[model samples]
Target: MFEEDYKRRFVFGSDYGTSDYKYGPITLGERPAVIENRGYLPERSMVSKILGVEKDIVVGKDVAYFLESGADLSSRMIYPMRDGVVAKSDPTAWRVIKELTKFSLEEFKPSGFGFKGYYIVASLSAIAPRYMYENLINIYDEISRETGLIHASTIIPQPLAVAIAHKELSCVVVESGHGNTQVAPISRAPIRDAIVALNRGGSEANAITAEVLKDSGYGDLAKEESLVRRVKENLGLLPLNLDEAINYAKRNPEHVRAIYQVPGTRIKIDLAEYSWTRFLIGEYVFDPNHEIFQSYFKRGMPRPSDTRVGDITFYGMLDMAETIIRAVERCPVELQPHLYSHIILSGGNFMWRPVSTMKGIAVDSQTKLQHMLRDKGLENVNVRLSPEPQYAVWRGCIVYGYAIPANYRWEWEKMEGWVYHTK
Candidate 1:
């Protein structure tokens, strides 16, 4: 009872996503603390020395204080994970990750009786290599020894964590973020060998949005990535049928037309006559092979090309349904049906909702994926958008840490269990 009570209070969950990091202790309830997964390295000033400001790297929202103007800020800011894997030799990236971890731990460090340290469960990308695991564990070890903020730590795949959060042990988890998408089958544990990697995600949606902006005479604004993303999120509509939705938008211009006012600024982007281009953003994410996209490709908008990462080949052009099908088929024949019956979509990339005004023309990710799969003759398909997709991984981490026995030592072969002892 004592162990269970202690675990419930002290277990910490960290989700290191491509665009953001969500972290907190078990007591945080449903949501976790989020910060852009980037860090800023500040150049020491003489005034800072006099003030006794000694930290080398600044993380989370506090990075705003150390940020430089224009070009310098961009150069100093480091985003550790691109395709969910950090390069082994990027010392600066590693330092940022370490600082971010320590920063979060320290921020929530409990102060009271019987509180020695936290037992942390961190969720990483499914395709993260052995070196990533090693480096992360080493960082945790160093932090534990130095600060006594971590009692034990373990890393689980983001997809598996999603499955745990949703309580779907025998399911397929499609985790999409800014840089890439990972479709992994989880029977009892994540079937790493059967994972399907995709080099397309929210960035792909943003790419099409930029093109739409350029074609619609917002060429100057299209150059800004952040503005492009905001435009994509607000105006992008996932269509039931790409061609059908395009026709609907072209006809009922008033209903589908988008006017997004940049928050806190007078800038309002109105896709007046070019509102039909909105469907292009969502369609490009699901299936970019449509001939309409060829014009954009011809016009010098770089296509999402296939890339190889270790043993996995992240496909660029394959539709989402095809990608999921390919991943599920890699598993045993008997489990395929079970896997198909419970499909969970988790992450910021899958958060788009269908507009009520668009009706049959636009559909959410769940409906769109279901239609795409049913068209391919997989009748047993069931897809669900994870609840509060942003918090799923972190919640799973908390549940994982709370349930696992403390005596179970880290097993390198299976890559599950806790590290009671660290360097």
Candidate 2:
């Protein structure tokens, strides 16, 4: 049996990120977008964009900042949704969500549980347990009652929410997020039973690139991971003459690729570029033979049934593309037949195309991606890009908010020791 004191009647979906929070207010009727700046106080301009309210209602700093400044402190707190579903498991993360929720409630509608409807669109990982769901409901119930409203809540799988947000009935969703890279199989307006998550993601990609730069005689260039990312975004690509480029770097170690200016430091504006002679730094995405993957041999190759990453050098843009393709190949073949029609590439990683440059080559990450997907025999697969790939999960939650039925309700005691499933 579940405790009534811990139940919320409505479902709300949220996609929390490192820099911002994307969520939707879900009820029986209309669903509205809810965006918040969890990183810092949002500017008035940003709040105006999301709330769609007159500037007079939201004068200056974002809701949380304004509330913390003592404008009106009685408002109850809302839970801060995080990037991955389980991020809240961190103690520090819980506190952050608490503060962010308070900010959310202060600016918009006053949150409460007494309301007739409430449902949650959370990551599938978030709803894995009955007790976890119950605790989340209890938190919301307290928040609602403190603000003088009734509590009602339910949850939607995050991958399913993302699919809904993308409006794709059949596709392979590859989310290269800040914390983790997750690939889920979906079809016919629903997620398939097969899904995979890897410890690697954008953060790891950046870290690895940074580490490579530091170790390869470009120590000064290595620390600027963010700048390296910007350069990668603007200039990274799969070189057409992959072999020549590899040979070139090995020969002319002094050739400069790009120059970047580091702000507010005595460090002179640094010219950052990779030369063929210098041993490629962060080029593993292009070269399958890069030394990084060589460690897999020492650890022993994974059994075919095991999904472990192999060495893939950044020899060209194809390296990044191969990761996605390889992951797809690893999926249970029986789960996704040849009929799957789409491969929805989401995340900031797929943002550019490879183009030729004056000094050297530029690898278009996207072109390599498309070519690899086609070559992998999923020719029926069409590449679908999620608008604002970073926020797709959040948008999915917003979409899920609108989809809940008016009669939907979450009765915890009725679901004793049972794993509940709904759509």
Residue pairs in clash, model 1: none
* Worst 10 contiguous positions by lDDT, candidate 2: 309-318
* Most accurate candidate by lDDT: 1
Q: Please, what is the TM-score per model? A: 0.95, 0.60
lDDT of 2 by residue, 25-106 (tens): 5432333344533322323566656766432222113544444433223232222332343343554445455444444544
Give the alpha-carbon lDDT of every model: 0.90, 0.46
Please state the error at residue 350 of candidate 2 in Å.
3.1
lDDT digits (tens) for residues 1-423 of candidate 1 = 776677777999999998899999988888999998888877788866787867788898888777666567567778888878888999999999999999999999877777778999999998888899999999998999989999889999999899999998799999999889999999888988899999998888999999999888999888766789999999998999999998898789999987999998998999999999999999898899999999999999888889998888999999999999999999999999999989999999998889888887888999999999999999989999997888899988988998888777799998999986432
Top of the candidates by TM-score: 1
Misplaced by over 4 Å in model 1 are 43-55, 421-423
After the best TM-score superposition of candidate 2, give how far the Cα of residue 310 lies from its true spot, in angstroms.
Answer: 23
Evaluated against the true structure, the overall lDDT of model 1 is 0.90
